[model samples]
Target: MGTHQLTTINNSDTFEDSICDLFNHLESTFTYKRFGKNGHNQKGIDVFSTEKDCAIQCKKKDLSRKDLLIKKEIFNDIEKDVNKVINDDLKVKIDKLIFVSTYKDHPEIDEFCEILKEELNTDFEIIYWGWDTLESKFLANKELLNKYWSNFIIKTDSKETHFKRNLDLKKKIAKDFGNWLNDSQANRKLRSRILLRAFDGTQYPDENEPDEFGQYSWFRAEIKSLYHKGMEFIIGIDEIQVFEDYTWDFTSNDNEPKGELVNVAKVGQINFSDIIDYDIDGDEYYMFPHVFCKFIHKGTPFENIYYYNLDKTYEYFEIKDKRK
Candidate 1:
């Protein structure tokens, strides 16, 4: 409703908040919790409202069969958390496990969610808020909810107000996600990158990705060191230039000019949600997530490499001592 930016605009949290707001508006009995393999892991499990109704997340950069592994891992990870919420938190068993994310339903997602549901004995409702869901949930409300929240509530929300209100917020949030997706798609259009390394051996953040939700990222010339071993190669780049000094005429492989490269280490991105700071004690939760990552070394086929999430990147970044 307010025309301010989402401060903590994480894909998972935002998605969960939309779901939570819907449930809260409808006065549903729920509490969104952070959970995972190591006891409330939080890498996934966007919403853990009670045990009966729940929402999960698996953010991906690209929706590929590779995501099936992550989905399976997180889904199993939630079993104990969901069980605790059921037997411990709310004393009620869950009927369905709604797993939502930016990932669309491909052979991987479809096959995984169904297999996960059957294997885990929990109904996994996967929601991929791709452009389709965005248009239907947000663009659809363009005419009615543009200036009239009341009309929107009256029209779409009577029995399922939670679902309705969440859909409303989903519209706004998806706009941002769509924007990030667009940028990524644009970068992909280039189809090539020229890496520029650092002299100080300092690690830099990704370049292609400047997202509010930074689970998936790309650092164009993340100048770490002189192309030593241990650091994995990223995909889609044309060539890499490891210079002795920071000074380099960094440009596209075709000599096209882009943004000026600075000495600052481009760090991970953070995204805020519209529902941040809203009291989230009694709201149900849901999610939409996608993570696309690959490494391109020497212009050959890029290899896909999966990291946990943006948080891990930040944590790992901070823990690393400044390159000597």
Candidate 2:
């Protein structure tokens, strides 16, 4: 959801009324009464709720252009409201006083509230709800925002909601180069340097060990096939140390090889439009949109792309004869 500014609402009265309405649903027992603009001017409170024992004062200032002059105006208003509540009979009924404004919350308000509370020797809780607080509540109950304060949100749908559009873009790229990628494999194989995470408990290769393709050789590579893109034998280096410590250098400029020689496996090409999420450690992430596109452009799949395959080492699987 986009950020909703309270000042952008039609009028200050409407903004104040909508706030009372929000509390009506949030607290079922709360009885909200508005007495601000319609001939009956509220003493200080714009809205008051009996069940919640609270009073709200709403202000819709030009929050975008905040200066010392504007801030002094807000402070003066607060001082006037506090003075009114101090002498009023309703002060005894409500314990919580909330000041709602479209402006960004400042630390000075907290200091001001503490000073007022101490000077008056009152147990009443005084607090200010700035743009941040109001925005959160508005987002939580979107129906209220849509009906009463629709103008706050300039765009109903934000860039975060464009997951479908992003996927479509990826698919279009694949389609544009699909035929060439398929046919080029037979005529000329595309070789790429891939870094694969090591299986758990895999021992790091000893410096004394010979550089060869074997389980004991401490260096291995695997070939992953992109179905739509075609069959290209990708050399995946399995790191000697645990996968966590190994930083993947996309340039492959580091002179040391990380993992042991592992078997090559064929994977079916993934459809970008309808790809399932990859769940790792209870976190869900869209796999195809992220990794496949990277492989198409950067030659590196998402981290832990081949972790499952790395777990079971295949001695018989070979890429020597298949390498072009």
Candidate 3:
């Protein structure tokens, strides 16, 4: 699980419904219902709770689409809504009026709310629930978090440890792949593509010029062997294709061989397990799981590869000639 952030709900109706659900979750004793459609003649209240004598006016605003900074116009809008609730004649006596907004909290907004509260001189309590407050309540309840924002989840201590362990395992697999590329001396070749960061004097040796178009370049290279200096793993290639003049071609008339340092993070999808010789007669053959590499700047390399583990089962393969 990863850290959670409350994303803006694009649909205004959906945002109101979610806020209703969140209200119910927070005040379990009270059942909150959505007020009339389009705010109609039902005053400024968007949601209400009869049991709690509470009324909430939802303001769905996407600050990202607008200037992120708080403005005077928003404060004016808040004042108008508060006044509507104060003056409107309703069936139930509203003891609490809350203004719920998707906007992130700002000190100016808080000061404005306080000033409104003082000037109103109303019997009911005036409250403002901003993005920060909503996020805290959503995180406290997993059901609300999953229902509204499912992309990211709350990270507990045990889940955090598991995530760290999985990351470490992926790093180890990358190092092991580099070693396998070096030790597999057999004349077997795997057709693969890799994305390389532009020739930087600090990271990459100045053997090739910097790409004219961008900071990253794609190369179709044959994985021949691997060499390492400390933590850096350099890959040796024989047939190299460079992108030039809007086409991929061999460099110069004499197609020379070259070596490139592999950025472990940018390693493309080359299933080393596909080339393994399965030994059925040997002891229990443990198959390593396939790791789909995520390139930094490029789109997904292969769409056919299933990136998710749906069944939660570990499938193993037997390696007949396991390289040392």
Off by over 4 Å in 1: 1-12, 22-44, 48-52, 56-92, 123-131, 142-324
Q: How many backbone clashes does candidate 1 have?
A: 40
lDDT of 1 by residue, 258-297 (tens): 3333222222221121122111121232112212222222
TM-score of 3: 0.47
Which scores greater on lDDT, model 1 or model 3?
A: 3
Which candidate gets the maximum lDDT versus the true structure? 3
Better of 2 and 3 by lDDT: 3
Looking at model 3, how many pairs of residues clash? 2
RMSD of each: 20.2, 16.8, 17.3
Instruction: Give the whole-model CA lDDT for all candidates, comma-separated.
Output: 0.35, 0.52, 0.53
Model 1 TM-score is 0.28
Superposed Cα deviation of residue 73, candidate 1 (Å): 8.2
| Greater-TM-score candidate between 1 and 2 | 2
Candidate 2: tens digits of C-alpha lDDT, residues 86-191: 7765543788888888765767776887787788776578888877777777767868877876665566655656565545555654564354334533343333
